[model samples]
Target: MSTLVSKVLVGSAMAVVSLFASIDINNASADELMTLNGIGKGKAEAIVAYRKNHCFKNANDLSSVKGIGSKIVEKNRKEITVGECKK
Candidate 1:
């Protein structure tokens, strides 16, 4: 039973790590965006919307969103990628 529990825990952690490994804001879908901490469906949609309307110059551009402050950006920076598209 303990081994089963440990395996489950490790599997869950690995899944989360893999999820994070593939989260690139430049290309993430709404579902993927929602997986990020502090980002709900609305914010995820907003991010997609923002990406459509304007280019993300860098991680800093996330701050332009009404609710995405620097702290949030800082926390999720590793999960995001601005790509070569920038100001």
Candidate 2:
């Protein structure tokens, strides 16, 4: 690719990454959870459902949700949290 094109691509990737905010698993809405890499509508809903019954103490606790494994948790660890969501 041309230098300009490459730069644009890299910049776009960085912009996308920057859009992801830290999410609180215990109180995040499905839409909020969907912002994470690897979490789609289904997984996001599952997270909300799981949270209804269990509280996530840390990022690793995300693995308790069906379909959410350690890999998904690890991938989103930097953007996941267990505290209350900021309004």
Candidate 3:
């Protein structure tokens, strides 16, 4: 491939990566939650379940979930977003 084409592809990939790097806790599905740094199937499911009854106001609220903790929230800080949830 030509240099220009390669650069364009790389830029597009980076943009996509950055776009998904931040996840909205208020609306993320179980699979989306799994993309977090320390989140797994179980944790992701728990987050969804918890979200059903509670609206997380911030990334720190994730720690309140059964299997989640402050460490996980801290690690995924940059990846978590709080919006459209309860104030």
Candidate 4:
């Protein structure tokens, strides 16, 4: 039982780590962006729109979007990255 619990905990941790590692802000779709902390449909759409005209260099760049603030960016900082914009 203890060994099973350990495996479950490790599996959950790896899932979380992989999820964070894959959320690239520069190229994520609205649906994908919505997975971040505090992001909803509207904010995700706004992110997509803002991204269309601008390039994100870092997670902090998300604070420039109309509805997104520094707090939101900070919440997802470890879960976000700035990858090449999908063209």
Q: Considering lDDT, where higher is better, how would the candidates rank from best to worst?
A: 4, 3, 2, 1
| Per-residue alpha-carbon lDDT of candidate 1 for residues 1-87, written as tens digits (9 for 90 to 100) | 699999999999998787767466766789888877798988989988888777777888887877889988888888877665432
Write down the TM-score for model 2.
Answer: 0.73
All candidates: TM-score: 0.71, 0.73, 0.78, 0.75
Q: For model 4, how big is the CA root-mean-square deviation?
A: 3.2
Which residue runs of candidate 1 sit more than 4 Å off their true CA positions? 1-16, 84-87
- Where does model 3 exceed 4 Å of error? 1-20
- Kindly list the per-residue Cα lDDT of model 4 for residues 6-66, writing each as its tens digit: 9999999999876766588888889999989999999999999998899998888899999
2 or 4, which is superior by TM-score?
Answer: 4
Report lDDT (Cα) of residue 54, candidate 1.
Answer: 77
Q: Tens digits of per-residue lDDT for model 2 on 1-87? A: 899999999999998876876888888889989989999999999988887777788898889899999999988888887896333
Q: What C-alpha lDDT, on a 0 to 100 scale, does residue 85 get in candidate 2?
A: 34
**RMSD after Cα superposition, model 1:** 3.9
lDDT scores for all predictions?
0.80, 0.86, 0.88, 0.89
**Residue pairs of candidate 1 with colliding backbone atoms:** none
* lDDT by residue for model 3 (12-70), tens: 99988876677999998898888888889999998888988999988899999998889
